[model samples]
Target: MAIAIAADELESLFDALPDVVFFVKDAAGRYTHANLTLVRRLGLKRREQVIGHGVAELFPAHMGGSYAAQDRRVLGGETIDDQLEVHIFPNRAPGWCLTRKHPLRVRGKVRGVVGISRDLGRPDARDPTYERLRRVIDHLQQHYADNVRMAKLAELAGVSLAQLERHFRNVFQITPQQALIRLRIEAAMHALGTEGSIADVGVACGFADQSAFARQFKATVGMTPSAYRRMTSTKE
Candidate 1:
């Protein structure tokens, strides 16, 4: 005979999974139910505080905007399968996660969204291939101010250029070159918080010139370096 779990038992199971965050939100994007993982990650003392709030009320503006958009997509009867994403915790830490969201249907009509996010631990510690990939990542992080060649990265990983690219895509869903750019941009962002000239920050981050840095930074971060610095400055 098949076994069936009761509703309360199913909820208890969700609460027991510490590494996974589970939540249900109404079509209007208000939280209806949230598991203990979500509650703790949001730094809430009780679940009741999260029951009626939306993402915008809890997360940083940019991250909250992204979540709100995804909620709209799910409510429109779309299912978002496991996708890698960067999530910001209430403690202001950011990490990679696998996120999935599906529409909650009532009488054949989409009524809300149900979602889960599981943290993906440090890339280096995950698998053998990932350990090799980590070597390349560490090298890039240390030498981001230098012109990093793909061949050098591949050689470090003991793989061909093509194999290195495939591994990066499989693990991070981004190419090695893209990862390099992301690293450079992140470094530049941190440097911008200091009292350095924009041109200096650009060059320090390995861009060929200030214009090139500006273009790439704007493309990747959705704002000019100067603007980002000013915005973050105000917050601080």
Candidate 2:
């Protein structure tokens, strides 16, 4: 025999989970429903405020624009699975999260998107393997402007190249190389907010050239660095 949970009960279960945000958006990218976790993370006093609102209404332009593009992708019948990316918390803190989005289909037509984002706790504090990987992550963060070597990271973690890749995937669901790129992209995002030249920002973030930085930045952020900088600058 098996037990079945009601719809409301299932929703309550999702609401009770800590550090997990859940949401549903319509084809137009309007919020149709959001869990309490999402509501709180958006700093909304009530879920009603989130209903019918778009990401642009709830978040800054740079972040919201990325989210809107993601919604469009899902609504176009695409599924995004277990992507490692940065998220903004309710208190305005930036953190990494494993995010997934799927298209909601009704009668074989894509109606909207349903998504969840699970916060990744401090990279250094997750477990013994993660603790070991922390040294590499810390070094990457500190030296994002310089070329990073996987062999050196493996050496720092007291592991071989294969083991380092395995551990990084097991613990962070990303390759060490991907993590390094993410770090550089994050650093570039921060640098874009300053008065520095775009090429200078790319150089500071370890890209081989401004073209390379723009390519990677657009791939990861869903917009060019110049567009992001313009949107964020206007917001500020």
Candidate 3:
């Protein structure tokens, strides 16, 4: 309904979050409020173009436009939950969005719609036990900067620590702790490659100390953290 000059600072705080949340409107039936993460996933230039744009507007042309019915019901006041398969233009690579959609109420009546979506592209979300264990993974990924424990992960996943481990193995073919290590370490590597310092990368990815980060980095990437930074710098 309006051009997006700037994201409301109150709301844009969520944009810094890892989860890719954006508003979905029935009238436009496309995304408004596309967070930085969502835009990156779709390889889009800016969220500004999406504001006030319709599905018809997102794609110059698309096949079928299959989601209109589901959108109509939500706009008509029925809550719907589904995993959405959204089509991004160009290559049309499939993107999975775990979504819960409901009406946007104003005073007492519906105005439009609101939906929150989390991308499920990681190899981790493939578990048959995922609906059970992956919620833990989600929680950890969300608060990765904090002190997260196996017990906390288990509580979020609604399973015992042992059960969480088994389900994580069944789905991701790795132990839960191993999965956590891989995620954190890989996150550290990404931060380093993207212009973060050795200590900054370590802190952002949850290692409590630089020595520990260097130890884990060498074990995973066969190089110390400083060495990796030097190598990356040389290549650039």
Specify the highest-TM-score model's number: 2
Clashing pairs in 3: none
What are the RMSD figures for all models against the true structure? 5.5, 4.3, 15.8
Winner of 2 and 3 under lDDT: 2
Candidate 2: residue 113 Cα off by (Å): 1.1
Residue 236 lDDT, candidate 1, scale 0-100: 42
> Model 2, poorest ten-residue lDDT window?
1-10
Q: Score candidate 1 by lDDT.
A: 0.78
Clashes of 1: 0
lDDT of each: 0.78, 0.80, 0.63
- Candidates in order, TM-scores: namely 0.64, 0.74, 0.45
lDDT, candidate 1, at 55: 91
What order do candidates take by lDDT, descending?
2, 1, 3
- Model 2, 1-236: lDDT tens digits are 01113323544677988778887777899987788988888787898999899999998676687888888888888899877776656554566677899997767999778788887654444556978898888898888778788899999999999999988877877788888888898888889999999999999899999999987886566568898788668664
Compared to the true structure, candidate 3 yields what TM-score? 0.45
Please count the clashing residue pairs in each candidate, in the order shown. Answer: 0, 0, 0
